[model samples]
Target: MNQGDKWTYFLGCYPLYSHDADDNRMFRIITSQLIDAGLCRQIEILNTFGVSKSSVARSLRKYRADGIEAFFQPRKTRKGGRVLTEDVLTKAQTLLDQGFTSGNVADELHVKRDTLRKAINDGRLSTKALPPEYTTKSCRTTIDAEAAKNMGTACTRPEERIVAAFGVCDGAPVRFEPCIDIPKGGVLCALPVLLMNGLLNGAERFFGTLSGYYRTFHIIILVAFMALCRIKTVEQLRGHAPGEFGKLLGLDRIPEVRCLRSKLRELGSDADIIKQWSAYLSKYWMDQDPQAAGTLYVDGHVRVYHGGLTKLPRKFVSRQRLCLRGTNDFWVNDATGRPFFVVDKTVNPGMLAVLEQDIVPRLLKDVPNQAYDKDLIADPFLSRFVMVFDREGYSPQFFKKMWKEHRISCITYHKFPDDAWPEEWFKEQKVTMPSGEVVTMQLAEMGSFIGHKKSGLWVREVRKLTNSRHQTSLVSTAYDMEYQKLASCMFSRWCQENFFGYMMHHFAIDLLAEYGTEQLPAGEEVVNPAWRQLVRERSSLQNKHRYRKVKFAELTLSEPDANDENAYNVWFSLKSSLLEELEHYEHELEGVKERIKSTPKHIAWEELSEEDQFQRLSPGRKQLMDTIRMIAYRAETAMAGLMKGPTIDTPAARRILQDLFITEADILPDTNAKILTVRVHKASRPAVNRALSLLFKRLNNSEVIYPGTDMQIFYELGGEGHPQNAGKGVTQTSPK
Candidate 1:
């Protein structure tokens, strides 16, 4: 179509190209843009207008290579066409430094305002006056607008990002700024306890650094603090004010949920790091208190998986009394139930195998002050250490092997025992429990031979006679151990179980920190699907056979009324059919048994067919989170020990400590003296205040320094002038 000297091209009445008819460059650019955007195909233009293929390709190539600007550039331009020359750049910087706004500087220097701004942002030019220092003012924001009052920086640390990009800094240093009435300042009370528990130990060596404001140390401390404060998951950070949590970390604000999740994934990338760190802490903790490690209580807690990621192997959850899809964590704890370390198993090989392969081996290395070999030889009854578990770990052969091979004595409930000894054998005696409570008990001891004759283990069989006339039997390889101590240790296995219960309720230990699955180790052995199927089928057949046999026996034992021939006939027929069915079931059961025997019970992971193979829930992040929770629990336990007086029980003491952790406190940072005084506010009750005062006083004596800072932490009970809500204690949220 033509109108005056202008012309337009139309496709199906829609204008495709419109420009002055002589403007071929404009036409080329528009058509190439349409083709690049997939709005119009090149073939359409080539066929519709009979344009040469080379001409269209050339235009499209320009659009692809140099963008639309290529269409406007002079084809043969000289190099001197640049407007921002060295002299102009120098003048621009001079104007910027002379208090000239970026727009004014750009106008004066005949440069684009964006160009001037970019130069300033890139550090090529400096503003006339520096901005005020950043003071944290807001909460729960992606960008901290309070940062240095420079809105142009997008509130994000642009300079730090640049430096990190250039590998100049690994992470932001922990720099604390002074503030009053900081929320959750009481959580800082845990810093000393966490450090003493080796929360930050081996962190630098194992994790290296995280490339952001929240470094490795920051993330580790954040997680530990979260555990202590009962922040169940990373996602839960959204519910709390990030700025308030940041005060706990000595940061402007905590990392957002997504950012924290990414950090966790990065930290958990190497599963081996979690293992090594846990091992290191185990040794460190054991070294701190050798007697506690002498008798380690081992137990397995199943963490159920309710995700759709993969079909995890089902394990019988004793607590729930149902076989649930989950992973098993076998925790080895001290006599007081303070965890040393935990071993997780996806395809569990049972308690016996785990103790033999994983737990005992680590114990051999970490359990300090073990009796020397020469000492063991001089006294055959002497043991390196004692392993106390429940009846689940009981095995005559295992007990024998532990004593014979490693001399690591084992104490567990006797899985099998002869009839209880005569009542006369029991004697009343006072047994000092691990908790230092003295209780009277009727106890007796004897030497019992267990396992096969040649390889049998001579174990001390200890029995506790209760008032109800029930005898609780216990077996121990620690032959020389006092019978009362054996009974005490045997009963102390409940501490590990209690640990599981308390952690599940208070610490959310069962919560999955991350969701995803990883391939199980190559060549790892798992239960054979085919064999399992055969065994299941065999059991079904056996059940049917037993039912039919019971019915047949009943028929044989019964006498049908002789007067009624039809009744007798019916009975005979029913009995015959039942017997025939039983015979058939027996045959099927035998066949299934044979199949089970032929099929390997366990097979390599790779040996499974593609459809049968499965991935395990990623344990790296969960294990890391579990270890953090363990540290939190141990810290609380240690503090509770300090708080538990004759008046307070363990539970009450722990409750008070939890309240103390969340109580508001004044964080006084003395930069000059390098001291961080955490003046915790007073509790509602004077008793609690006194207990907290004594607890903090004990903590103060430790001389522990805050992580990433040289400032020594000092604790005190705040005066009554502080408001009750100043540091509101965080209570563990009840599980939904």
Candidate 2:
């Protein structure tokens, strides 16, 4: 059959127009099977398939005799006088100029490669021009050999001066004696926890003294304390008096914003060391309290990029409901909503991919061993690492892999269920929140299983029905966990979201850590924008073709059949035109398909030329900020746990903590008794004053001395009347 006659066979489930040569050849194979199986009777096939009985018979006989090669294939027929369309020729030239090979251009324009070559040879089209974006150029960065050689071990301070300042430690360990001499302002409240947690504890002047008044420890402390005080950015220091904030670090004056950032760069240069320190603190936390890993919440927080230095791929910021240029940071927090750790996802990988590839593997190695104690958790099932996340980790295959391969159990929302649980399955239960509030809610579990295999070895899926006829499904491998408890763990993924929200609102978590682009590694894989555009164009054309085909069919089916004569010719004329247009779109779609087949989904960053090659952002400052913010939050959270009930209202505790951090208190140092007393004067609110009194007693009970002075910490309310210090008059008090 000719190409025109063969299109009449574009009927049945496998439409001929919708497939390529390979697929049509498979279609013929399938047809042979059906005819042999007695499912394809010639009369019925002809009636439904629009193909004549004679052609159908011929195709079946030829297919059986020749074993699948006898089916009619589309042939490349040259129209004797048909000239290339202006649009197609223009497109072909444009692609050729963009460095596309002649064969590629020919395929894109639906012309024979030989035809394109002849056109180029005859000077009808030029394949010599090159688009600027695709042209490669050498990037030269100057290197001062002497300076580059000496850069690593260059110490600004003389060795003699360091030995003089910090007495020469000839095998004597350099240690920071717990100084009860902590400033009693906003910093005193959390310094003990911060110090004990070992955030800036191990940081020392290993390479010798820096130029700033603050040592490395002091610089790190200043950064953390700034975040604790809700001074989210360095620029915010402009609003604060330096002397006032400096007192928090026991310094006469705080370092300038530039100096602090410089120190951060100096200290943060050893990223591996800092990360090890951070990991030490996390492991220590879990070691002290294994319940912290009772259920770990994992999710991604997209920090939108507002700068224009380099364009990041657009990520959907769920908060704003708008996709914007940003970086994705996957955070893993414990059941208490305190962050375990956060990973900066530089390449914009999806939440699930990052979880399995980076987050989970790390957790499996670091946690589980240190997080669970034999005596702490009575439920053997609870001892298994239970990771809670949202629907991003919802693949049944992933869940199965997590359980079988790594022995890591997870809780996440189930996304692919068709029907909601019946109303009778749901019942109200009083669930205790992490904040200790008893909440009454309707929750249900059918113990429904998931997995393609039907041996019933699958995750238990639970659902929570709402008044609006909505159902929220949670699937977990924690089969031994109580249904209510499982439901709670899954729903608590919001705590991580809340953590992101809180950090963004109060700590400027969304702020750019630093606006600097770094050199991307050569040949790093990146999405091919040109290939993506081609896919988009192909999809658009396919959609248009489908739409026009439907329109053509509708016109032909609805045509007036007033008689089988000249009266209905107008509608017939319209149908015939639409069909011709539909055929043109189909042909163009085939050309697009051919083009898409050869384009790679991702190309090396170096392939895009120098300007596009260096788009990856630096993570140094962001990592610094994330570390400090987590420590500050952890300390704040610990203090909040103590002030839960009558001492401080649980709900308003975060605000109260902020107030305490910003409050002006009198620093009373009783070095004679080895006790430092902080006399907090009258607060703006009496409740705050009362709450601080209780918190002070609680901190004193811990007997945590300050970092450098030998005195037990003490907190006292003003003896009688006191004036508002306005962040002044908070000098360290001496012992009588």
Candidate 3:
């Protein structure tokens, strides 16, 4: 209601207060009180009364600070003045005379550049140009160098940290500039293969772009190069020239270790996203080579943790022959040992559990060219795909279940085999291995029942008799496959093992990517410490009981000659004592067994007592790094495949690739033509140089574009008598 220019406000028809419109101070005080009393909301006041939000906020802040009297307090006025005080001007003039720029002087004196320039223009200050030796250009950053080279002004293009500081640019596109003798320039040769293997596939979608100088693409390529160059850890980056390495990335320099780690932390904030990226890449790889996907090799590699931050569960590290605290990574690789994906388990449930629960489901979905439903029904022996692993996955029940439920086959070393077959049963047969090597082997096959007689499953058991007359037995549910192929496939499981060893030695696969630990999820189940202790106790008692029983039985108690009654009495006493101890241990073992049966084998993480609890190593960053390394390994493998010939075998080809990665080369960037020419220098050996030149030709044929750039990569050999110019009076071979 309004009366004589005064307005009254009401809530639910109850009068709140009345005041004239011109009485701004009273209005502010009452409005603040209404909001403070919860009679109205700030938004409601602004919306219903068409008042500015700042006005309402200011009124509330003033009232809250000084109560209602604050609205009537005197209004404050600004006290503005020239910031260039006499003392500040004196210091600025001195800095100007000492070769500092006007902008620098303004920054040093905390004054505006325009104000400083005005002072100079008024003749109040004088400036001097520094000698060429003292100029800032003498110390050029990567950004400044790129700018001088006409490669644009953005620092680490597509993502400029400098401009991004002011929120003007989101990312700077990747650009290249010409350079001479860039160290490790040969790493660019693998870029095509890395891209082919989907190194950056789904990266932007999953990780988004990092907000600073290093974009997702740069970090990934840098990491891949580091892996290829044998730079195992981020800390190793400090030992190398950042500017030199930055050339490989087409940047001024790779980010500092701390900057890289922050970028990694931001990219790996979510573990699920990393897994999704890995899965996407895995599908791409499988889809690219469906033949390799037909048979997958599954195995577990333990990454031991020596850190004292958290107490991880102990796993038997077969390589070290000792139980160690670590996590297990179950890798699914193709027959040739190229990785498809990996599943990490901090609380390992064993190979069988992982295959059935984590691995098989993924294989069933990802394994391409599964037999049609009608085709599967038409042929009883038909199977969708085969899984090969070590003996740890040998389970007759699992084999039967996979065949019956999923129509999937399994090949693994038999956990238990009968005595060797007759010598004449084995015949020498030539087998073609996955590596295209044919070898003669004494092989034989027979149908055998595994497990109990009544519930056992019939499987094809193939055995190979070595030159030493030792039989290597293998079990397979693939009934229709020939014994020769089964033998080759089973033996090829070593490819995966070799993959692990090579990665551990060269790629540092077992190293911890990060040292952070996180608490395990509440419902995550781990082995129960109490149950494990009870089992250990029972085992100790059983061993003691067995020893005592042996002692008691060995006491023959032969009747001593009638003349040696003392000897007979001593023997009887010892035998009686042994029997008594055996009986005691037997009783104790029974009690312990009963307790073990009563205790739960696995308990949730939250159920454990404080002292028994532990956090698991952070998997997010490790998983990301592992994926990049996997890509790097695959790329190297692909290049090695191209380099293999009569002179260069797989091992030699890989060695050449490693050397090529660290070899110096000249980089010629043709911006107009959009081509990046990496001229690799010749190797010490003429044979290796010829092989590298051939490899480069093959890579150029693919015409793979550099990631994050439009430039097509062109690789060639440098130095005299290069293979490309061999016809021009240049010998292909160089003498020592």
Candidate 4:
């Protein structure tokens, strides 16, 4: 055959059935030659002709059971028995004894390693015995049992007490100290510890001296309030301790609220007192534990509302608007969120400069005896740890002064550009950023910026899209390697947001809302000390007045009524009205269902007579169909428990229904709008129908109705300035 024909003959045809007789004859000749060469047997040749080599071996075993004639005769098939040779067993035992390599032995014996190894494993061969002294039993039940019993005895109560009283000293003596006092217990001890360490000084001074006036309840409430408001003010103090003038002053009777307000006013402007308290609390906190390190987070927030109308010279304007800013510079335990030595101050160039200068010195002085390992963290506005301005905050003059001060250790984020990164650093790494985009970058190939005086600031430049089309590059000095993996900075920014969130949400002292108002004069404008003093004095007085006006009893005590006849009568009337309204709604719902079921069914156009099919639908028929569908849907919904009738009489249900359905038109001016709106809607058929559907859905679902009143709901639904559809929108006037 030709090459193509040969190719088809080999691959496409069966050796025994192909028309290519020469190819089939060649195959038989090759098989017979292989059998004659002892590569295979005669039975193998027959079996190969019949099936395969493996089958040939199996057929030979069957032939031995029923003679050579069995090849032609049919016999029941049985599993072949193992053909274990003496050589295999001998090799297995030899390998197990000498730790002979399994692969090497299998190659030498011309057998599978697993098969030989399994023979040894199956206990067909014995591993040579080792010396008695060296061979240890794998399992020793007696020793284990003895050890468990001893452990049980050691764990007994008497043994525990002895162990507690006398601690083991090495493998010899025992040391005992049974009378050691437990560390001071509870908040009482904690407060003193905090005070000694200077953690409570700022709070103590701001809230007044804790020596004779601090009551446990007052302190607890005050702390709770401070935690809530974030910033302590005279106004908040009065609000939380209303009516109990004595409680405010730690006395038994009600003191004049004015007196309490006066005291806070006196204490309010005393920055020195707060400073002293902050120092004391810081000291107290530092002394309590030797192993704990103190790290303080210092940050500033601008209370923009406070400086609203404040007049200032052009020089005093730092980046624009009037502002009463406060530095929430505080010390906190690194391991815990406990705050201490807080100082809230008005921000000005001089004040800011002084506060910045004093923070480190005060912290160091407070923790004088302890090792000074603490670190300070803040934004670029704060000076570096070594007292140098951060490169981001650097100016030529600032750096010159910082160099003179020799506090370069504090300059953590600064670096020079001449330094070449290592080749390994150039390995590419991928990061998924806050915007859910994958960014590929190499650590070694990052860029740097030059700050005020050629000071190098290492920053990563990232390209971000602004307003969709505008791509802008941002440089960031604060690098969070782990945040790169997340889809958003939300989780990473949580701690930072929480600090502000606490001040806004919990403390009610949203700096943005409460401060920097026009009412407070700006710093430079009040450069004249006497005028500034007058402004401060007046501000304090105004604050005290505001504080008094906010006073309302935080807790009230009421006597129980001896006669509840009026209450009982009111409740009975309410219950009766609710039942009557519920019954009426049920009856109306049944009528709607009956009306829907009585409607005529539609006839198919093709099945109808040609004249009837061509006729246009009458307005009356269309209305009937619409009415039928609406009623049927309402009935089915009601039966499915997806809608419910409103209960009457009960103010809550009436409130809900009226809020859900009635519109502004249904609300009459000067009337009891809550009740009158409901009455007006009841008189309007369309309003009533709409109300039944809307209120039933709302009430059945127990959903909260926002703006919870008919007038509000109507106005929200585009009722304002539009009268064409005001009272006739999407609602039927006639009930079924």
Candidate 5:
């Protein structure tokens, strides 16, 4: 059809019937062509020649249902057409049957070229036996009768039958299948088994406490493991053989490559989900068991880099990192050897605020109010009553402030000149090491430092020790306490260092890689500059200046908003209400009549200023503000406790948890209780919930606790003996 005619015809279809008269005319012509064909006749015949009113209606219904193209279109023909003369037909059939060319038949017939072509073009002829190139080649193989007979016999040969059974159509001989079986007790599976056992009952019962986001986090880690240890390329993930990975995960079906790629791309862009998942997992690790009141270790570390790459926007940094920088910070539970919260940032004032105002509050919320009884361990960077500072964090004023605030009971070690202490307190004293070695010492004790001049409770302890390697002075908050036995606290510090190592060596490696490089071709840079220059001169000077000013304004003040309107507002409102209640209580005064009447005009004016006059003042305003502030602070602290960024915690802690909890089921014995294993290609809230549901259904169990390595033992031992075996203290298998 011509373009206009086609358009007209197209418009005549449903939803476009309102088009001009030209479209209706095209539709009529198309319908007329359908009527001319036998399709209309067949419809009329089926409806008894449309004589009966019902029959006419049926015929019309059939006509409309079939559409114009279906009624008028000819039947589709096969490759070759009809044969003309018997001889030409015979020749074509013989060649095709014997695997010869159609062109060969045309040449052998020695007739006008169009004669064979016409026969082939007709519907009577078939070219099913011809190869794809038969129409182009003139050469034909003459069949040998004896050879054809032999070939027919060869098709039935036992070897050929065996080849067919194996699905090998080619003529090559088949090789025997290998019978070797590898033992399953190798190191490859041990690590995951061990991790699973630890996760179930040892300390962190991760499975039982897993949240939606935490589940997603685990899935992401699983994907990372797969990428690192199983399949390496995106293409491989897409086109992977189902049998191979299916056997590994015990899956009935394998995910497509597109699904995995889509998941990875989604996770890369979704920082919010990552943050939520990180927090959820941290909480899960911390609250694994109620009996275990875990000690959380907080510290900071640096992620150094060359200055070529642009940094991520400040808002993208985790809330934990926004408070603390320079030194990486993490919250580790010493009881479980699990690092839950971590953050990394450059050294800056904003980062420090995040640590004190954000991270600490959240962590403390997870910790019961009574948890203050247990000292929070940190380097000198974190100033607490019981502060531990290395050479870099040494500050006398910091200790004094902590003492005044009654925030902590601390132990810090220092070294300085003898004159730093008072002469009377420097009298002979002795300290003993765990190895039974004794050293005479003089301690320089301090009553008060600069900031705590009035309180006078701050004290410094100093000692002099002589050794073959070096003779020097030692200082500490743990005055005359023995030195060597404090190794447990020292070892705790080592765990923090290990966490730092993991962040740098594992998680940060990939993140830094993604940010540091330009993925586009070098030529694109040259083209980009030209395009920018071309657009630069198009606008008016005033407009350009205004745009520049606006852009600069955005960049300079682009930090995360103090009160983000779009954040979880329900929680915010709840906090605001609580503050309002607290303010109401604070403003309540007994016998207010006298104070109100006797108050001076200036004092009354000051009271009015203190009131929120900009907004309509409420009677309970003071109590309300107090309550809301307290609630908001508590909630913020709770959330902060759960949040852990990739920068703070090392991959080692995650690795240890994974090793203690996750394991393969192939080597274990089967049981009536279904063993559910889900391989989520994508890690996210939805994926995690779906996986949990599937696992729950498959196991026929109500609750599926995570990091539950004990499940492996139950799975292995089977039946009533399973729970008993756990009671007997079974050793955990290491994860592969």
Candidate 6:
């Protein structure tokens, strides 16, 4: 089209003439636009472009109705191909700097092999004088096993993802037949405890079955029994006679160390189910006895990872009195040392974190409102369930938040009270420990607000005054509970700590089950180590500046200008030197201020130092093993609970249980009567023997069945009234 003057126009995909295109059918459209712009008349336009006047009018009608959008084809762009990210490039460059070949760096960074080849070909990854490939060795590239395992071919199925792990394969589980005697840490004593706690039934529900002769019930029995014998590591089975433990399982041989480890790993794979099962078992415990749910003790136990070279986060190990790389596990136990459940702090978050975020919320969700006092909840206000922990959980925000949000109460020791109670406030009263032992303590009561002033409340505080003027205060939210009982609950927090100590020594509760790790979530925020270093360096520089300032003042404070020329010159030189030093210090401070501005305060886990992101193992397997150990400890505790009263104190009862658990017993199975008789050998100590007899009578009343055998277990003293050689040995008698 011409505009009456000689106009030069470059037309490709037209930018200015957007409302018209090649699909307009003729130049009539262009002619109409020309007339609309007063470049020409409608009839003159028809003549100029060699088109009809009616067509020009019609084109004008279309332009007025449809507008510019109707003339253009849809625009599009390509997406989701290769991602040439800065991170990938930086990593590749770093690898090259570290002497890795181009191919090796490409493989390491998971960049496509061809992408790296193209990068070198296009000069994106290499320069001419010192190309990335030429600067490094010509090493062959290899795929990462972990990476290969994650991504697979079209033939791979989702179900076939986990390749079966291979180790020294032990034989399948098989029974040794009847009459074969195995000491097995005398697992017979633990029979009632298992049956009482639903370990056998629980395993079936949670773990299901194994293909071998050993069922879910068999593994549960074996692990608990092994724990009783202090056989912590499965490798310990190497020293023990497998056949001896086999007899306990009604098998020809106990599953060897390999098989046992395999079983635990298998359980770990189904960690979710086992976790649910643990909850199920704990609920059963509380259901059997409602009082067990009254007030629970919560604490975190550190299990140091001594075997691995992992750079896991450090936790304070109380017993070791040092910070060590380990996992932090929070455990919940009832008043009498019975385990409720434990959750692994996979990131080693402290007890208070786990309590508020996980344990307390879970407890509140699981229990009915006013579980301790049902009537209190009927008025549309729920009664709080008490949790007794140490002073570590004594944050005002934590206490107030738990109460207001979840209606959960906490009884941690008072942190940093101003003064001890007066002597007159102390009154002698008997307080029963969680173990059922009653002790006389001088007690006092008062009230104080906890947490922040706006969100906190006035709660009862109990003080236990000692003979040496030492006083311990316990803060409680259970205002209506008896003062003595509340004091006992507060003091009973030790029972949970003791429970941790006992498990560590007996069941290897502190042992790390696996040394495998996975990458943490990318969004998890952590302090940048580089930033922290910068901060500390700044502080150090500031301290040095302060010292120099003080020194400069000290030199200048008493000196006056000397009347003598030599003295005046000396003073002037010294003052000038001091001023120069001050200037030097000020320059350093300014540089530090600039450096701090560039440093990041926090970064996502992905941006963390490589070691910090994945130095800790996943808690799945540790959790599985932990649950097994909890059941074992629970069994032992059940026996201990029954041995209470004047005859046996807690320590004495423990000794009795130890003897009973280790004693040899005769196995007698009556097919017709559906009974399995365990005639236990007596203890050397007469008092223990008496306690043993009483414990056996109680266990026999439970009439627990042998796992896998389904035969009711009956306990009896092998030597009748005589304590001589009672626990040494017993013969399996055939029932008539």
Better structure of 2 and 3 per lDDT? 3
> What does the lDDT read for residue 274 in candidate 6?
71
lDDT tens string, model 4, 1-736? 2343341222234432223334643444444444444655666556434656665455445545665455556534322215347756676566556533455456666777677666556656554553343211122223233434654211222343344346431111111111111111011111111122222224433444322222222433333223322223434444432212221111222213454344333343343443454445445545654322232333333333334233322222222454433322222222122333443333333323433465555654554343222322332322222221212333334434443342222222233333434444444557554223456644332554546535544444333222343322333333432323211221222233344434344334432312222222222122333333445554654555444333311111222243887765665565556455555545554554455445333323344333322221112211211122222222222222322334332233333332332121111111122111111122234443454445333332322111111221122111111111223211111111
Q: Give the RMSD in angstroms, all C-alphas superposed, for model 2.
A: 39.9
In model 3, the runs with Cα more than 4 Å from the true position are 1-161, 557-559, 720-736
Candidate 6: residue 551 Cα off by (Å): 7.7
> Candidate 3 has what TM-score?
0.77
Off by over 4 Å in 1: 1-167, 561-563, 720-736
lDDT of 6: 0.66
List where candidate 5 sits over 4 angstroms from the true fold: 1-218, 224-246, 252-261, 265-270, 288-296, 305-337, 350-355, 369-389, 411-457, 460-487, 502-736
> Which candidate achieves the best lDDT against the true structure?
3
Q: On a 0 to 100 scale, what is the lDDT of residue 125 in model 6?
A: 65
lDDT of 2 at 327: 78
Better of 1 and 5 by TM-score: 1
lDDT of 3: 0.83
Residue 41's lDDT within candidate 4 is: 64
Candidate 6 lDDT tens digits, 1-736: 3344322222454533432234344344454555576655776656654667677787777666775443453534322235556667667766656434566666677777777766666655662243332211111111122223554211122232222122222323322233423354356788667666666655655676664444566676777777777778777788865544566676544565776777777777755787788788777776776667768788888777865646666678888899887767788888877788887754655578788778876777565334454455563334467888898888777776776665677787889675776799899999887665789999999888776668677777889898888998888776667889988888777777778778887788777676577655557665677887888888988888788788778778856667777877877788788788889878988987898899887777778766556455766677766776777777777787788777676777777777667777656555555666666766677777777778778876665555444456677665432212122211121111
Model 1, global lDDT: 0.80
- Between candidates 1 and 5, the lDDT winner: 1
Question: Which candidate model has the greater TM-score, 2 or 5?
Answer: 2
lDDT minimum window of 10 residues, candidate 5: 176-185
Show the colliding residue pairs in model 2.
178-706, 178-707, 179-706, 179-707, 179-708, 179-709, 669-733, 674-711, 674-712
Cα-based TM-score, every candidate: 0.77, 0.69, 0.77, 0.29, 0.36, 0.66
Residue ranges of candidate 2 with Cα displaced over 4 Å: 1-184, 205-212, 368-383, 449-457, 521-524, 553-558, 561-570, 594-597, 646-648, 720-736
The candidate 2 region of ten consecutive residues with least summed lDDT is 135-144
> lDDT per prediction?
0.80, 0.66, 0.83, 0.33, 0.35, 0.66
Relative to the unseen true structure, what is the C-alpha lDDT of residue 257 in candidate 5, on a scale of 0 to 100?
A: 53
